[model samples]
Target: MDFVLVHGTTQSPAGWDRVAKLLRAAGHRAIAVDLLTPADLPVEGYAQHARDQYDGERPVVVAHSGTGVLLPAIAEALDARAMTWVAAYIPDFSGGRSLRDEVVELFAPEWIGVDPTADPAKASEFLFHDCDPETEHLALDSLRLFSPAVLAAHRAGPAPEIPSTVIVPTRDRTLKPEWMRQAARDRLGVTALEIDAGHCPHMSRPAEIAGILTGHA
Candidate 1:
């Protein structure tokens, strides 16, 4: 499968550098896409960035963190074959169309601590749990903050139904892990898997995440 992985807010595609290497080593097609949103723009704008890159192919859409909200639309717009989300954000919209109140609720407290002027390294601690101090600092160097408005706007729902895989990181600091798992089942009819990693499983346990994808592949 042609797997195109996406990054979340306050992030670029750099986090997938290591995972892409591992995927290639295992003879799998892995492409980490660049969701080029402004440094200070709301992440929902980044969702549109994701939509613009769609090529309407059967590539596996892999979304990490904030981009999950966008990938559903990407999959529908591009007519993707499947999706495998890694600790991704999935919104359960209440009406015909609208961002859930959960948007601001999900990251509010965490957003409060991050100074709008602070860089990625400082933000990583809040999004991920128990990562190497240096690794966290290094990975977060490319971070950016998203506004609540952008995230809400990016809450585009998926087509009637689609096949998807959602991997919930049990120790995740970003979202309630258990709730995310149940969400995969309720929202997207996802074939759910649980990994014992934090928000960035591709970084913390590349092989294991790859293993699950390959198993599905």
Candidate 2:
């Protein structure tokens, strides 16, 4: 399958270097993109950045973190498949509540904290619990504060209406694991597969992530 791995906030496609290799070793073509939500651009720009990179190739799209907000629209454009990783999948894009809905709020506050400084230690402790210090620092250093609109316009925007999968990191501290399960169930209406890993499993647990991808159609 031709797969595009969409990253979350403060991330670059470079993080998937190991995961990409894993996918190829298993005979699948994969590309990880550096979304346009540079630390400078508003969060809204990240969606556009992803939209520009989202092509219907191989018919599969995998999105992580903030990029989840854009997947519904971008995947719609490609008529492709999608897999969301510990991210939001809201619905009702026409200015009201979305056609999709979820109870991600359950895991908020404890696991995920919003600090403006983008502290690497705090972020790593929450997002990349299992990753090494250097890798974790690299990941945190890439983060930037996103627009409130990204979270604000959420329920008011379209949700991805495609065959999809949601990977919930059971050990996730960044976004609550309960939220991940709730998001998967309430939005996609599927039982999420739990993995013993952190927020960026494709980085910390690439081989396991790949196994799930291959296990799917």
RMSD values, in order shown? 3.7, 4.1
| TM-score, predicted candidate 2 vs. hidden true structure | 0.76
lDDT of 1 by residue, 93-206 (tens): 433343445644454346444542275444565554555776666566645544345555644544436678889888787666876877787777775798888777877777
Candidate 2: stretches off by over 4 Å = 37-48, 54-56, 86-107, 110-117, 133-148, 156-160
Tell me the lDDT of model 2 at 16: 69
Give the residue spans of candidate 1 off by over 4 A.
Answer: 37-56, 93-100, 104-124, 146-148, 158-160
For residues 105-213, what per-residue lDDT tens digits would candidate 2 score against the true structure?
Answer: 5334554446623566666776677877776665565555543445434554444457767787777766667766766776667788888887778777778888887
Q: Would you estimate the TM-scores of all the predictions?
A: 0.79, 0.76
Cα deviation of 35 in candidate 1 (Å)? 1.7
Best candidate per lDDT, number?
1
Shift in Å, residue 61, candidate 1: 0.5
